[model samples]
Target: MPVADDIKSSWADEVELEGGALPPSTEVRENGFKIVTDYKYNEDEKKLKIVRTYKIEKRTVSKSIALRKTWKKFGESATDKPGPNPATTIASEDVYMQYVTSKEEDNKPEDESSIDKLKSLGDKSVVRCRTCGQEHWTTKCPWKDTVLIGGKLPDDKKGPAVTTGFTNAETGKPGGSKYVPPNMRDGAAKRTDSTNMARRDDTTAIRVSNLSESTTENDLEDLVKPFGPIQKLYLAKDKTTGACKGFAYIHFKFRNDAAKAIQALNGHGYDHLILNVDWSKPPTHSNQ
Candidate 1:
């Protein structure tokens, strides 16, 4: 009995010296604690406590990537829900703004010149430079330190009409302009000089070919009236007989109308003859 009592006393002393025992690589601190190994245990009547601490590092995210993530989350939520959600709405707005900014960046010219910017404007777009109040590059601005000298080419001026007070010997008509020298004119121009000078072509006009000689201007008008308003109708006729020459030009008030008339009337049969309709070629000279 005495030996057993001595052994128990020695064991208690050993436990006190070792701080009531601890897990491997763990130490007993004088303060609250270092780490919590288990959820069990407590002091007094409370549940057992395990204290722990960690040195957590903060993470940084890029704006683009963060926006993308938020947008993705919002999309998922919207897909699951039937109606609108504030979170999804905000996300969509941000995403759309980012997309537009990206597109602007892509479309931006490398030089960023006002001239380049003005040239890039589409039919629907109009850009006015803030510096010059003109639709051109800012760097080329007159108000800037650098002056743009003659950025535009000189105007093409027709050297004053060569007025030669002469008359055609056979025609007995006063010719204010000298005839283009035979050697100087291109061969094509020389061959069709008279016809080219006498005839004119309108842009908003459709030429009808393969027409019956009996086809009159009135008849052509009736055929094209359904498409648009008629500006003028000229049915070629024989100067002597005053009979149609089997071809005519029909001008429309609008180019769109002319195009529509061509589409509807081309290859259409009129007066028992199939008509060929197409855009009239513009004349070379203003006189024509």
Candidate 2:
């Protein structure tokens, strides 16, 4: 059976598809190998998981190309004759953080003040948990599962109501039907080219925040320029307040710089809320 390489697919959409209809169960028992045939469907994916993994040892055991190669790679790395295990060391992690403010230790100007340095390298810092009343970071918070505001659950929180379908002004063909929650309207991206070409620096976007309440579009632009060559800075605000909505966007001249900012701020929050850093602008052709 031809299996799909849909490992990175979403929870609901990662269905395995077989190319064609399969022949009825046939036992192709060779000299020393036993062959088993079955068709099983993975309920969650609503797809098939035709084959499973197992090991068999015989007087003269032989494995398929894929398994042999995988075994060779695993065995080579697991050997203690030399180097460290690359697979064991490389893993991605998610983290939560908080930044606190304090009065400057030096007589430097407040605006140009630097963060106060810790007294010693191994100094014990006591942190209060956000969810629980524990004396440790949020990761170790015992009451992480407890209710915070005693209101609606975060998962139960609902926002603006949405229409299931809308009249299609363009084709009169149900101009907009909501098959998915985010529906493509979340972005102005082209599907055909998105799977192929990438967006250029001029089209990249940045998530800018912590901007002063009096910061105007012009001031936001000037602040972001020093980070790197800036393509654009988009500042959205409440129409009545005239105050910054605690968020702004900046497009960088290069994608790397934008990625750097995202890495620096995402999860590592400032003020409190973890910034939502993402590519807001869609990809274009000329800039690439």
Model 2, TM vs. native: 0.25
Which structure among the candidates has the greatest lDDT?
A: 1
Q: lDDT of each structure?
A: 0.58, 0.49
Which stretches in model 1 have alpha-carbon errors above 4 Å? 1-201, 284-288
Query: Which lDDT tens digits does candidate 1 get at residues 150-268?
Result: 22212231112211222232242323334555422222233454454334337788888999988777777787899988988889999999889988888888889999988988888
Error of 2 at 13 (Å): 74
